[model samples]
Target chain A: MTMSHAIEVHGVSKRYGDGPLVLDGIDFYARSGEFVSFVGPSGCGKSTLFNIVTGLLAPSSGRVLVNGVETTGSPSRSIGYVLQKDLLMPWRTIMRNVILGLEVHRVGRAEARRRASALFDAYHLTGHEDAYPGQLSGGMRQRAALMRTMVTDPDIILMDEAYKALDYPLKIQLESELMDTVKAAGKTVVFVTHDIEEAVTLSDRVYVLKAHPGQLVQEIEIDLGTDSHAINERRLASAFNDYYETIWRSIGAGGRTEVAA
Target chain B: MTAFQIEDAQTGAVRTRPARSRNRHPASRRRTLLVFLQVAIVVAFLAVWQWGATGGWISTFLFSSPEQIISVLAQNITTGELWTDMGVTAQEVLIGFAVGAVGGSALGLLLWYSRFVADLSAPFITAIGSIPVLAVAPMMIIWFGTGLVSKVVIVGFSCVIVSLTNAYRGAQRVDPDLLDLMRSFGSSKTQAFTKAIVPGAMSWVVAGLKLNVGFAIIGAVVGEFISSSAGVGHMIVTGSSSFAMNQVLAGVVVVMAMVLAFGLLIDLLERALFRWER
Candidate 1:
């Protein structure tokens, strides 16, 4: 097994023109085939950090290395980013939307269609290839978004609350599917979500974060002894609540939960 | 009939679900009645007007009864005068609409590439757009002469501003998320413009086309009114100068028909283009 990191963020800090640092000295890394998540509240600069990792926004201080080379000021195709919203082009059919990256990369039309068709079948979106995004359910749209990202075959995947918009049942189902797909591909994933249970269930390691100039609080390695690919089963593991409570406390939402209880 | 079968969430038993009733074909027999009522209103209106004119209850010379206008239309059609005028006017309106709407949208969307150019031209575009087409019509005629060129220029002028502004606004309002997605893919600026920005602004561009349909017709007719020997506008002007109400109303009827035809054409286009939206 390769122990080298696939992505590394070295003391990254971001500030907007004399404002307080949006991200304060964030040191993060993801090893090959590892699933890492940043669990935090809103305004925690998770999105800012994701953008920096994607090279869309440059950090004020420090650098990002992708595949061991510095990638600064220029976005590379080595990373695939799936955002909170599906961002599917409404004018395009599901099939067309999935092939957008290939199209931008100047892939041949026939080849792009062929590659995209395989994803539709594997993702169980076979019959919906021709349907527009508007006609699909929220879960299906999110699935298509994931398919769009995965088809590009980026070594590192960055998801920013990608499944937060789905209902509980769909979220769990997609999480399982995502886990299986990433495992089979052996791709490193960096996920950001405010859902503690989600972070606990899906991630191999979780980074707890606090708001207001977003800083990392703790890093917890999850070892539930359950199949991570089976996210629902992982939720039922004995270590689930302990990990959730620990991350929840780090986020400082423990008081509210206690009051509610 | 059963459309499909599914397991009930609570019972875990398979249940056949009936197909949804679209109600596309209503059993209520009101379609014919509605058509008859609409026809009745129009016929009643014409009958009352004709009766009033014949009985001297209204001034036939001023109002030009429907029968008199029909007679004038028939005469003009037989002489081929009305056909020539309509053809000229339609040609101008259509050509102007094609050129102006397309050209303006292209220029507006192209502005997306350079924020500096867009910001620079904002006030100038507003100033030019605010200037009434009537004020510019004479200047256009003086420069280009009272030929088809001037009329075409006038129609195009009336259309260009609205289309430019609408298309530009639409491009501006495109969801930033999509642009971010494009950037994440490392798409070139031109690719982003063509694949994302242009398609994003299409609905607004189409709306501009619809609005410009009216402006095009108005411009053509008004150009004819200013200085033209042939066109619906000329027919209306000649009839008015001679106090021939029938000819004037005939010209009006022709223009109304033109507007309706263009409106229907645009509606058909909109339907075909936006099929994916729903």
Candidate 2:
């Protein structure tokens, strides 16, 4: 029961106005309903890749396909992007903020409102519809942001370090919940993160990119088993050593010297 | 055994209850006290001024008593002359404000949309804004005559620059992330302007309008002082020339009332327009 590819990037390269290339001939793909993570050091062009994929920036070379449709410099309607910041409109209520994407896409007002309401319970945001973004806790704000992105019903979601702002405990909690939500929704996701454990814990496959003209160094398939709640310390420790060590070595981190082998 | 059971149930209920609300009663009381203190200060100052004038500590001719000003206001009100002059001034101010607000907003949008226009006209606009409206009033009178048109033009001239500068700054200060989000959505230039740029610029626009209300009043009054025959400013001129201190004070009071009323109206409009900001 293999899934079809939801997004495909082939030999994509991006450079800034005759400057050094940021992304160099990167090849990546996410299967339908798959969760994939891109992990690397700072300045590794992970965010650049997310931008190019979402059509915010054009790649210097190569093509991207979304749901088998060729998407070269095309407006990214088929994909939803969640930035690091919640980016909720401070002036809008929680409900209004969640419906912003649908509003932008010109979805009918009534239908957009209907879709936004359906996520309230699922996202644990019930009873706070009229509250402004300022009134929300950080976690609740992020949840509203996720609802905003998901309300568009995009087949693929592009997240650029979306949970990096949360504290460690909250980040872990959110990562697990988000993974469950993405899995249940059956949407493909391409997440960029600096944290290797986060990449491994949430992703079905992780692409390790190298810095300075970022290139895909390795792609590792994660097998975390079917039980979503099986996030035991032992499993995390082992995955950290196996995946983080390899990724670290690729980025010249003295090959796992920081953590026990 | 029954006593222990009851205590255990009570403790369980207390543990299950939600956390106490964070609302502060003392803070609200302090805010009320502060407002009361402000009103008291204003009242005390007005009382002292009135007492000094009436008690002969200050010459009545130089500084009319509050009672005298009030009586003059009442007499003028009963005769309906105050309303006529106020209505005329109000008309000029309203017309000038409308023209200035619309023209300034449109020109600001134009400059925001085109960098060339912004750079080319920056110096000229600055020069015009820097020239005092009083200095330009005589020329305006020569061009438009001692009529409503001259007063309106003067008010518009005084107001347009403030609106333009504030609006331009507002439009230019759009959040980069919001713009990126719009761009990612493939929003057309017009769509982006309507949704992101316009709403973001509204606070500044309202602020400029607030300031321009006072400027508009000044422009109209000064224009009338220089030339007009039928406004509160003209009444002030007649009163001063005749050495009627009470009449001059009455005219001043009317002008102050007009300014205060316009300022309050703008504040109400701001509240309605930017309710989300609260």
Candidate 3:
């Protein structure tokens, strides 16, 4: 783990009420400005870990520190969380929904609109300012969710399966735009997804989790060619196959973790 | 409509036959047929009624032939009695609906925010809501007298109960995820209530009003029936006493028309207010 990381999830574990443990002792960190992903099959506790890190749920054990300061089970402006569901308010217009965070923070409505207006065009949501979430297509709805997250300009962003609902081309386009935006702003991003290729393409370091009482299985550091920015181009690079194969084999081994790889 | 068809990209085989091939002319044709049948049914029913009266197969004194009812309607229209009675009933209903809507929604919000108050009042509210308004109409007349006060009170009472119930249910049904989102943003309880809860309850409020309008009209007529001089209920009661079947049927027809007009107004308001719902 990098020193003075933007997030520190030290030995986190979770079990709801008297239910079986959903996660075992798991620890990870995302350094400042680094893009990290947590990936595994269903029931691997990826979302459970995310909820703890974002302070939405308190871990049964251990604590999370944002920029080295603990904020467990409390709302914090330091983190922005985008859930798998878009969670858009159906009643509000797109502009109003996107500015919800600013409104919650007590920012003036006019000022919030000003800040949000600049992003509409860049996010490909220019003409939909007055439209409701139901009016937008599925991909556009997810993009609006992203815009809602990014507009707050939080110190750390934790996205839980943010693009899984979308189809291929739109997902790829959104992934690139989000990457470019976060990279330019130098914000720490922790993404959770089941798609290994998505993790490999977007993360600087990808941490794989084991299913049922989730634990950290492996951490792979991704190394893209020096100048590659386009995600699809990176996917086509010769080096890409090696990384995919390695991760795939590791996951297969992870299926029977007791056996030697 | 777009489902179950798979032209496999690699093998290029039609794996599953599209069920019923829904995108054909038959669907539109069927709708046209259904509409024509509806019009035909209404016309046939009206013709049968007119034939029964003119052919003397049914007693006009008891059934009040369509022509007699229509003549009564024309007489009332010419004398301006229909408008006067409608105005009186409409005034009572309007005052009642306004009072009930505002008061019930406010009380509901209070109950929503205060857990103890909600728990404390739960049994009493259910008990009160279960009682029929018509049974209490006599008591209302005795207390408020034969003027508009009694009618308005009954209408308002009916409105309050409905609005309160609907608003409360609406608040309870707010999406839990949205609540979490608000909490994650560090929104104050008040902010969450105003921004999320209120808007979420709007559909429920509209639903409550949908019921309230009909109930309020019923309450108004009942109140007027007990002791009012200038309303639809008075006309119906007065016609019944004199055994004027035509007059009674005319009053019933006028009431039906007025209720339909109010219902249309509600529909328009619902469409305008909840335009985003669709």
* Residue lDDT tens for model 3, B1-278: 23676788999876765466564677797899999999999888867887898999978778777788899888888999988998999999888888886678767866778778888998988888888888888999899888988888898887787789889889888988788888888888899999988988888888888887788888888888889899888888898888888888888887788788888888998899788878
Model 2 clashing residue pairs (backbone): none
Error of 2 at A143 (Å): 1.1
Models ranked on lDDT: 1, 3, 2
Chain A TM-score for each of the predictions: 0.94, 0.91, 0.94
Listed for each candidate, the true contacts retained, as a fraction, are 0.80, 0.45, 0.68
Query: iRMSD per model?
Result: 0.7, 1.7, 1.0
Regions of candidate 1 where Cα sits further than 4 Å from its true position: A1-4, A253-261, B1-39
Candidate 2 off by > 4 Å: A1-4, A227-240, A253-261, B1-41, B55-57, B109-111
Instruction: Tell me the tens digit of each residue's lDDT in model 2 across B1-278.
Output: 33222334645542333223523476887798899999999889779889999788988888787788889889989999898899999999999998886578657765777878898999998998899998989999999999999999999999999999888889898787787777666677776777777777888888899889889999999999998788999888888998888889889989999999999999999888767666
Q: Give the TM-score of candidate 2.
A: 0.87
Q: Once model 3 is optimally superposed onto the true structure by TM-score, how far is the C-alpha of residue B5 displaced, in angstroms?
A: 32
Query: Alpha carbon lDDT of residue A191, candidate 2?
Result: 94
What are the RMSDs of all candidates, in order?
6.7, 7.1, 7.1
TM-score each candidate.
0.91, 0.87, 0.85
Model 1 lDDT at residue A159: 95
Chain B alone: TM-score in each candidate?
0.86, 0.86, 0.85
